[model samples]
Target: MRFGPETWSYASLERVSGQLAGALRSRGVQNGHRIGLFMTNCPAWLAWFFAISRVGGVAVPMNPAYTGTEISSILEVSDLRVLICEDRLASRLDSPPKQPPSVDVLMTSRTLQVNGPAEMIEHAASPDPTAPAVIFFSSGSTGMPKGIVHSGRNLVRIVQTVSMTWPLRSADGLFVAMPLAFVYSSIVECLTAIRVGATVELQERFDPDATVARLAAGKITSMMGVPSMYRMLLATREQPGESGKLRFCATAGETLEPALSHQFGERFSCPLLDFYGLTEAPHIIAHSNPAEILERPLSCGRVLTGVEARVVDDHGQSLPSGETGELVVRAPWMFDGYFRDPTATKAVLKEGWFWTGDLARQDAEEYVYIVERKKELIKRSGFNVFPAEVERVIREVPGIAEVAVVGVADTFLGERVKAWIVPRPGVAVNVEQVLAACRAKLASYKVPDAVEELQELPKGPTGKIARKELRH
Candidate 1:
């Protein structure tokens, strides 16, 4: 694994992971115990994840950017036994109402130390394939996010499916800029590269200039990022670097506009393929073939071999090809369920299919084209920004009578969070004040980029706010 200015050979990573596992065992970590990983994208993050999995502990990856309130909710729901967090992120847990699980703050400067033995410790085999292995939080439309659990078998199956579909060669170098906490980055950029024995170039965060320089230096062969990252790269006015070696760039987490895709291809002289999936199924559901992008620019391409996708109506009846409807999918491997939330899990997972809250259409050739989101979830810069979650935070601000959050189109970010507020009578609400309050409570991406003050927001006959009308 190669992170800017530092490279860890496979052997070195294995040794560190083993030592970390030994340390975890000595600290009394047991099989099935949840271990929270709250850190940025770094070598230590990966090492701790492997160590936890090696000791049969379920890994719960927490977004390092989450605020104290957000992190507290996850800790309460997950009931983690141990938390391995970077020193910088540990401050977020300083004032939890209830004391959180035992935390082991880690620094990059120190190597993992083992007291008794540094020898490799084999993991106990899980008797059931469905046993929980990892927990991921999905933005909730109602309010708080739900924890999606995946099994050990699900991880192996997703890696295998991705390796077969993309088929990266050992000589290739993969560049990853997306957050590792996101399932897309973890599966496509990390595990897939490891499976193919390809070198991974990790970036702690996306920087357009640094990314372009690496590509120009011919240090990376393939790159994976979200639509926003690609837009940033296209926005740069600098001369295109030595990009001839870049084979292709894959994008997901939000819709990839055909115009943006065209502009990126024209600028970089490489195919900008669209990838589509969700946290429920971490593996790519559909991906555009690099060679066929010109012919099928709008499509997300064919579904993977082991995956079944269909456009269905509200009744779960399959819609014919070329018709827009909800996209339902059944894959060989998928998330087990929403942790401790059988009600929510049952709502989406029916029989053998998972009903994705995405409106899409399918061509006769089985290529999927996303239309719009059926849910009220806002995706800004590849991160989920739940309107309700933001509203809950913003509603507490003084002089705020009511607030409604929606996603507005953006050239660079695909969609940015926008809030419409109706202030209380005789009180003045400033946009900057509302934003300042949100910045303290919500993640950076969830903060509203624009705020509008209205005497009264548009409402439907039922007296509920009409989000669709506000969107227009």
Candidate 2:
């Protein structure tokens, strides 16, 4: 039982993917070639992804939200020879980017349609498991997007290990509301479904009510989302019966609030699992299992199988358990490196360990609790306050629906905490009331100095709050 733009079972995926592989082969797409995908979440994206990997072409999935300039930078840097994009998205292209390093483009149907067998999609191509299979981009330290490359073997290991860590079966129908362009959702929801032969329902965009309807209709048995999605869904009784068929729910991309997690468990009667990962090393380096979740409420979970995690200080010395430091992860599914960026890659990938920019502390039981992204720390008057820490506290306010805490320039203090909040519909929330709520839970220095009400909080491509963009 498989579903997407078209009803494709596990067996059908193989047949269509093989045919698509042949189609690309006929179009001269070959081993180690870079093929760009510029469409949103759809069956075509998944099919072409597997098809590219099957024939050893590195699939470079581009963000549709990117501007012509941003898209040109990626195509130029990646030197992509061919791009398969939606017909509608093609209209957004700028002069086909005529530069030194150029790329060609292919247009998929503007709307969802069953792909016909293009005879060229029949040639068998040898696959190199160790060669690059996918290229995902992340904002570089140089203020540009850098392509991160992963191999076929790496993806296979992720599927195998995540399955071992969390038991997912073919009987499960996973509904993923997040964009597949993000490696987190791409692998966990899309690739995992393909690996386990499970059914998948893809939504182009995420709407709280629409997602609930899908869940209530029982079209999906499993779901994965960021914390913001959870908060929105819980605000209203959108889909009353949605939780009945759900076996489990996984939350990632931000810190999971314990209060909200508890509410989710009580309301749905399903355990809310917490997963931790990054774009560079894109799988569950640590995941809280269903049983462990109740005991370790704030923990991301024990280190995943085939993965090892440690906390180390600035000098690279291992920190004692319960002490916070940079997280170092060693996992089987980690990426090779950022494509063509050796310096940036070397900074994170050192001696078989991926130095995650995230800060965390471990307990005696080896459970990991993420403090915050290292860059998100606010140095205010010589005191360090984590924005996530403050945001979590303020979100408990009754009328606050979504909240993002960012550090803004201050005169006396190096930076001041600014809270951008989205109030619940038809509810009036005063800034003073929100500050009072935070004061009860936070230190004096952590209290937000200013509060701004937003119609909606800005989100990055991966669904996390785009605080950097907001700060500007």
Candidate 3:
């Protein structure tokens, strides 16, 4: 289960990480020290992760898609002692903090170029399951990021649960284009492959043609991505090559549109399974297989073997199966609460149940369907409007590739519905035309006050819509 750049095999990665661990030990990156990884999808990112784990230090993976200011905030909050970044992106960072003396900043190019003192890169073999493995940020608070801390055993539980649910094996080669910063893809696609002894194909970033080429070139058996990634992949011109290698395709990080899933699965001749998970309660909560989609298309699938899921109202009372409420999850592998933020942690983690702010409902058979985000609910003219419900109807209209519904400040109404859309390829979307379509499907009050077409919506590293950023 060795991995890194194609040229530097698994053995080389082990040697480099072992050498880097020794280097960090020499430079005073001791056990329990937090090390920040500020780089995009690359071998070095994974290299630093394993290296930190070797020395029992916590690896903090920052979104490489972040600007300098955003990255600086995480560095300060996590109290990072050592920062590892790609040399090319060094200029993105601003001046050093005035208070701290000076933190050690190392580059990947420097690490690979220099001759190391040790050569056990293939596998250093430090199996301390209790050590803190990594920390990721979840967008729970309005603008602030909540750090999610996960232990090695916690991560192992996640990986084991997903692999068992999907039933991936050694012969399966996984292709992951999502940012390593996100927990879902990082854990399921990257670490799970390593833990299960599967070959992983690494890409620096996702490109439609490049992604298609890799899927065709490599023995790619499975892929895990967000819904948007699948949309972009569908736009690529089909190549006459082997497609049977692609056995399973899973989508997460956001709700998957039924329209998109049907279209994508038909094109690839592979079933696109829909999965549901969150950063707080990180496990495969529900899955929609091809057969399940036929009977219950909207169901996110029945609960997993060990996971306890339910819907509860504001008063913490469990709702009936057919009623929609805040989706709460209680799993053995759930996260250990937010880091250094007890008040925020206590708010969500109550009575062994994680109050996932996501709105959902369960069927009589225990199937779940996410409706919308509780925070994303909007009030316009004293009427409640759930963005996902509006967007779901709008997406049903032909020629609409993507749509995001937001409540914009209005003079007349307290807040009016504003829809941002990305049109399908080669089709010109008219505002009046879309409004007419919405008028047919939705009530007058639910219709968008304005429809603005964009080339693409702003997406965070994990591929979720950066709704907060869109406020400006």
Q: What TM-score do all the candidates reach, one by one?
A: 0.95, 0.78, 0.77
Which one is best on lDDT?
Answer: 1
Clashing pairs in 1: none
Candidate order, TM-score descending: 1, 2, 3
What's the lDDT of the predicted structure labeled candidate 3? 0.73
lDDT string, candidate 1, 227-314, tens digits: 8888898777655465567786787877667788877777777777777888897654557476556677767777888889889999
TM for candidate 2 is 0.78
Candidate 2 local lDDT, 198-266, one digit each (tens):
778777766777767777888777878766667667776755676677786887766566777888777
Clashes of each: 0, 2, 4
Q: Which is the leading candidate under TM-score?
A: 1
Error of 2 at 426 (Å): 40
Select the stronger candidate by lDDT from 1 and 3.
1
- How well does candidate 3 score on lDDT at residue 411? 34
lDDT of 3 by residue, 58-112 (tens): 8888776555545665766778888877787687565333213366787675236
Please give the lDDT score for candidate 1.
Answer: 0.81
In model 1, state the lDDT of residue 206: 90
